[model samples]
Target: MDIANSALRLAERRGAAGKAPPLESSKAQVELANARIEARTADAALEAARRELGLLWGNAQPDFESVDGKLDALPQRGSLDELSAALGDAPLMQGGRLAVALGRALLEVEKSTRYPDITLSAGVARDNEAGRNMAQLGVSIPLPLPTKRKTPIANWRRA
Candidate 1:
């Protein structure tokens, strides 16, 4: 479509002009540092796993001790901007966000259900000897007028 073409052209122009909205530099630094730390940790974990496996079979360490990959540091990505989105969308962060939301929703539910459920009952009875039918409707709900306050307290503590 013409609109799509124009939007693509606009994006290209903005990219060429290097006029993209600036990202929060502090956030970017923290995010990138965290990412690097995670990378190093994961690398170390993998090496540990390998060492553990070797130890299981009693394989000796390499005599020379030359590591093919450097553990010191990783080369920086050209665009921290590019990585920001991926980090934000990472599974760990997503799960944490969902967990917080669930906690809040649960707290709301607990607050709403401070009392017990309301119930309704309907019944019909027929007596053959009397040749008459009787119908009745009733409703019953438990009331904890003296609120225990446990549910809200628990939900608050969890939240």
Candidate 2:
């Protein structure tokens, strides 16, 4: 589901200019995902049909009609140890870490913008008949001070 959301966001971003990346790649990714999901669903349903089959794998495909009844079986906000044990393999923690990593990367990117990039250019020319050889060098540096940082601060504040 997370992959699907990311792929959808990528597709939307690519489509912003009235076009997108090669349709073949996008379609292949989506179709392959759909195939995997269908296979998992079929396998889970097959496994759920038998009593011991359900216990061995613990495939918890919820029944829509019995969802409320199942939830009513548990009390709210109790047993932190059991909750942590159940969430021992949490993907959410990884997501939080990724968010923090991306935040740090964003900070670095902003700082990079604060220090302007430099470009160097040089040219060499010769006019043999005139007996003149000339060499020139040029350096270009963006003036970051003109930006004054206030706008960037406001942007961050707004965010």
Best by lDDT: 1
lDDT of each: 0.70, 0.69
Candidate 1 lDDT, 1-159, residue by residue in tens: 344445455655665677643333334445556666777898898777777766766875523333466778899875788888788899999999999898889878877877688899999989889999999899898867775556665757875
Which 10-residue span in candidate 1 carries the lowest summed lDDT? 20-29
For candidate 2, write residues 41-124 as lDDT tens digits.
977775555534445557455333222246557667759997888674678877888887987687677767767779999999
**Lowest lDDT block of 10, candidate 2:** 60-69
Cα RMSDs of all predictions? 27.0, 23.8
Of the candidates shown, which would achieve the greatest TM-score relative to the real structure? 1
